[model samples]
Target: MYVVIFRARIRQLDEDYRRSAERLRELALGRYGCLAFHALSEGEEEIALSYWPDEAAIRAWNNDPEHRQAQQLGRERWYAWHRVEVAQIERAYGAAP
Candidate 1:
């Protein structure tokens, strides 16, 4: 498994931002082999996590044109700063007591 983490410092989140986010998440889940996705926003900070089965899936998702456009928007309007990290998920554990 692989995880792509995007940490961003948001400048402003407009209505358009929320709409864009929903559409992107829908596109990712509907078309790509996106195992899971989550977005967290707190004041000016935001982090989004996307999980995939492998690097190939991640690459395909990264190359998506709509996603590219969103990236540009984020840099130009939405985010003051950002960092992206791709990590190999070594293990996952869960339990129910």
Candidate 2:
């Protein structure tokens, strides 16, 4: 498994940003083999972590047209600054109830 970490300093968020975010999450999980996705925001900062099977899936998702459009919109409107980091998961552990 691999994880993409997205950190952003938010500029503004509106209805269109919300809609686009939801749609993109669905599209990623349904079509791009995203294993899991999570995001959170505090004050003007946001962070998102998305899990993927491999680098190819990540690459495909990165090149998606709708995602590209969203990225552009993010640059223009929604985010003041953002950074994305991709890393391979060496191991994972959890407790189950």
Candidate 3:
């Protein structure tokens, strides 16, 4: 499995940002074969993690036009600084609640 982690120092967020964020997550889950997604924001920072079945799925989501547009908007307005990291999961274990 592949995992993408995004961390950012936020600038400001608005209605459009909220809408686009929701839409992008939906697209990832429904169309791009994203296995799971989680996002959290605290104070001025935000972190998002998404899991995929493989590298190809991750690449496709990254190259999606809507996601590209969101990236542009984030650079222009929503985020002060950001970093993205992609990694392969070698092992995972947890007990379901």
Winning candidate number (lDDT) = 2
lDDT of 3 by residue, 1-97 (tens): 9999999999999999999999999999999999999999999999999999999999999999999999999999999999999999999999953
Model 2: CA > 4 A from native: none
Per-prediction TM-score, please?
0.94, 0.97, 0.97
Note the Cα lDDT for every prediction shown.
0.91, 0.98, 0.97
- By TM-score, highest first, what's the ranking? 2, 3, 1
How well is each residue in 1-97 modelled by candidate 2, as lDDT tens digits?
9999999999999999999999999999999999999999999999999999999999999999999999999999999999999999998999932
- Which pairs of residues collide in candidate 1? none
Q: Name the lDDT of candidate 1.
A: 0.91
List ranges where model 3 is wrong by over 4 Å.
Answer: none
Give candidate 3's TM-score.
0.97
After TM-score superposition, the amount by which residue 16's alpha carbon in candidate 2 deviates from its true location, in angstroms, is 0.5
> Between the candidate structures 1 and 2, which one is better when assessed by TM-score?
2
